[model samples]
Target: MSEQDFLRRLPEAGHSLRRRDRLQHRLHLDFTLLLLLALVAGYGLIVLYSANGQSMDGVQRQGIYFALAFAVMFVTAQVPPHLLRRLAPWAYAAGVALLVLVLVLGIGAKGAQRWLGIAGFRFQPSEVMKLAIPIMIAAYLGRRLMPPSLKHIVVSLALVLLPTVLIMLQPDLGTSLLVASSGLVVLFFAGLSWRYLLVAGVVIVASVWPLWQFVMHDYQKQRVLTLLDPEKDSLGSGWNIIQSKTAIGSGGYSGKGWLEGTQSQLDFLPEGHTDFIIAVLGEEFGFLGVMVLLALYCLIIARGLLIALRAQDSFSRLLAASITFTLFVYVFVNAGMVAGMLPVVGVPLPLVSQGGTAIVTLMAGFGLLMSIATERRRVSR
Candidate 1:
């Protein structure tokens, strides 16, 4: 047969395979999850092209990042869970130590020291904690019985809070919150009690005043105030939100069409290729496009949760669910900031925003989830 004919017959060949054979074929990787990620990443590139005024620079960089992320994911999947479990503490310790190094010898930008630079390369150690904390918590709690006692919960909280405090000292509230939440979600999935959750919620509420008064920087306070009333500083700190909302609202149902968004192309929207990329997407692709993007995200989350449910072990389940919820936090926070529903933070939209650290870190987390899924499939056979 000609190569073209052989290529065309592959689908029929696949259809004729036995059910067990098909299952084995599918076990190479979670193709459903891969398809969803590809759809989102492809759409992101299109939006990024428009966001950058038809410039290819941002898109090229993002494409490279995606390529590297995929490679990392592939490599990560080859490692078994047992090894990952054994290495969890070492990884967590390394992450915490890096965060401390960042505080003492880190590079600073815009009055914040959140990155460590060595030999012309720089990365945020907090990003490492996002994945590391979850692994550490999952490994620690997975060994214990379900519905952990108050003692286990306290130890878990300490595990989470140590890195959180280090990141907070870096004055990176966004990353600190993310790292802390990633660990906390693992605890919740590990069967931490609702009464404890209630008590924690109360403590959070009570600490709000102290956080605002002592922990928050002046600019951070400005961001919160601006969220409450953008008009108060329309020409200053509120400018980004105002322009973002206008761009989103102007796109209507059908959008202004690709590369024609005046708000982004004309430089009215701030951070059009980064944190506020959603506003640019909304401006060029409209509400319908937003819905499509959101649907892709929903599918990814659903698949991740499905993987967690199918996982046979507590560690796998907790790690999978925590990674999924971390993705949720990224989407929710970025969307809320752009929509004027929450104070602006430094979060970039997952898989869509132009960033390297976040993309790589998140993809690695997904890879770990895939490893768990593959392990489950192997054991089932």
Candidate 2:
């Protein structure tokens, strides 16, 4: 071949290379992940819209939140997991400091002081802990010997307890539980034994009595009793529980259909746009819709776990697992509350709830998952 002929072919080769790059970018997305995110966010917007159809502003805020979440997710995916590990400690400390500030001088909402006023905007530090605790633990455990020692466990428990007790002081049990559970997940995925889990479960059950008698506020106690017998206080504390169950049951086979949730549109259900958003989905979409939602959640959680498993280092793996566990708790607790199996402690359905802080926090965790997923699948890789 002549030199002129070779030079003429170079442009074609470059064009082909550009095409390959575009295809690679598309293939790299992991379509199943996108599908799960879309379904959850899509249904969430629909539910939130119905939950607050009276306020166009609320719907606009939700739309903005979703867009912001997607933007954060994209930014996080560009960051390498190794870089995340480096940032974890600072993030954790920042989270704790914000949590402390909330304790000292924070705003109250519905009788709980959990948010800090920042430039006229309300910020929840507990939400920060929700993201930071897991990352911090993963960083700590990732550096240690595998199957961490007893001291390490105590330290980890301390990490969990410090934030938890403070949040509990804020009287925000739901966020505390979510934060604790997220940390515990890191330990569990680090190879915690079944025996240890059993012991922890027993401890939790046994301590609940003491917590109820000594620690709980009167209203908090009523919430537990309400869970046990929602019908007993149908006109008072149990009213929310009763209405939630009715909504779920009325959803029946195929739900009353979107925007047609009588319990929501009519204002029969309390907090329908926030804590009780699940009821809206259950009532309007029916069992099949609920199943689909649950399935999508399962996919997101499963993908998160897979990212953890494929992570290059221990810290990344633990962080990934923690993120999954956090998401799992949101789904489990909300569904449990809606199904009348647990107390209605104001835990919102992730993505579906109408709170700016919670929505952003949950999205941030997914950003971490995005970070992990975009990395090379193995340490060796």
Please name the candidate that would achieve the greatest TM-score relative to the true structure. Answer: 1
TM-score per prediction, in order, is 0.94, 0.90
lDDT at residue 178 of model 2 (Cα atoms): 88
Please state the error at residue 289 of candidate 1 in Å.
0.2
> Listing every candidate in turn, what is its Cα RMSD in Å to the true structure after a full C-alpha superposition?
4.0, 5.2
Query: Which runs in model 1 stand beyond 4 Å of their true positions?
Result: 1-28
Candidate 1's residue-wise lDDT over 122-172, tens digit each?
Answer: 888899899999999999999999888889999999999999999888788
Q: Measured by TM-score, how close is model 2 to the native structure?
A: 0.90
Clashes of 2: 0
Off by over 4 Å in 2: 1-31, 377-381
lDDT (10s digit) by residue, model 2, range 216-319: 98888888888998889799998898898899999999999888989988999998988888888889999988898898899898998887888777887888
Give the whole-model CA lDDT for all candidates, comma-separated: 0.90, 0.83
